[model samples]
Target: MQLIEQNYARMRETATRDLTAAYLDRAMAELRGELTPRKPEEKALTWYDPDQTVGFWARRMSLEAVAHRVDAELAAGEPVMPIPADLAVDGIDEILVTFLAFASRQWPEDFGDGLAGADGRAVSISVGTDRRLVRPAASGVEVSRDDSTAEASISGAPQDVLLWLWGRGDGAGLTFDGDPELVKRLRYLLKEATQ
Candidate 1:
């Protein structure tokens, strides 16, 4: 579904405002009473149940709001605020362990080559208190936190890093001190998938 695109220049200006309402309206319209069985053994899911519906929409709206707010902050040339540690951790868990895991199984090619191979390695990704280790089953891409001992470190404001991950920022002012190829590949994959 097409989500509303806001052109807010800064999230600091909008943080107190509620963006969830607009997302809820859209989600309700799109998923109303829809019950598409995801697996043969399980029953279909629907929005008719208040609890189920609210839970689903809450996650969706939260991510949507957080992502856009990050964008707004970036556009305004301000440091991106730390997504509350709890929220960030939950989001990372759901996206990597739940959403992307399923997507990878269903559409392996989307994750790239090493993700489908046996020698593939997992990389640990952490943002603030949020952390996860994901390996491409066939792809050889490896992501890990830079060892504090590295002579040089790749660094940027956390917000820029988050925006880069979300495929939103230009990455112009970001720093890269490690494997340039890996960084390039990561950026390429994000861009490719979003496109």
Candidate 2:
């Protein structure tokens, strides 16, 4: 951790915004090269499937870059721009489908209580017209689009939902309906899984 911090400090000392932009462009170009020659069976550690690898990184990095930009803007005492609806929706999908889904499966014992709630209990997240229901399943976690009733529901714009899920912003403008305890449990589960 100390070495990582030192490296970051050194980079910060030498990096200007223009230099960073140039570096990012070069890095992205190189990353694009990574996909060009690699076969599907080539080993890679990705959160999503091989067929969806490029799409997954594009969505993941878009959200990560925007979130990091927000951090920079905050440090500079500037207001942050909102994320686009499409990107934010993809971000939500990434969290629920990849991050949390894999994490719960990888650490079933830790997530057992949080995911395996009472029978018929589930939490729903709605961003505009997009709705996803998450419930504990025999396999680990089950996520699907469902308009049915749920034990708890959170509704907001896609950007707000993404930010709230990532613990970046307070959920002041969001609406939470139904069981508060369940919502809190869901929040805890998200944080734990992400960490």
CA error at residue 49 for candidate 2, angstroms:
4.4
- Candidate 1 residues lying further than 4 Å off, grouped into runs, are 1-53, 111-118, 127-130, 139-164, 168-195
TM-score of each: 0.50, 0.73
Model 2: residues >4 Å from true position, as ranges? 1-45, 49-52, 109-120, 137-139
Quantify all predictions' global Cα lDDT against the true fold. 0.48, 0.69
lDDT of 1 by residue, 129-195 (tens): 4444444444333333343232222345455555555677676656656545445544554443344
Q: Against the true structure, candidate 1 has what lDDT?
A: 0.48
- Number of clashes recorded per candidate: 14, 0
User: Candidate 2: global Cα-lDDT?
Assistant: 0.69
lDDT of 1 at 174: 60
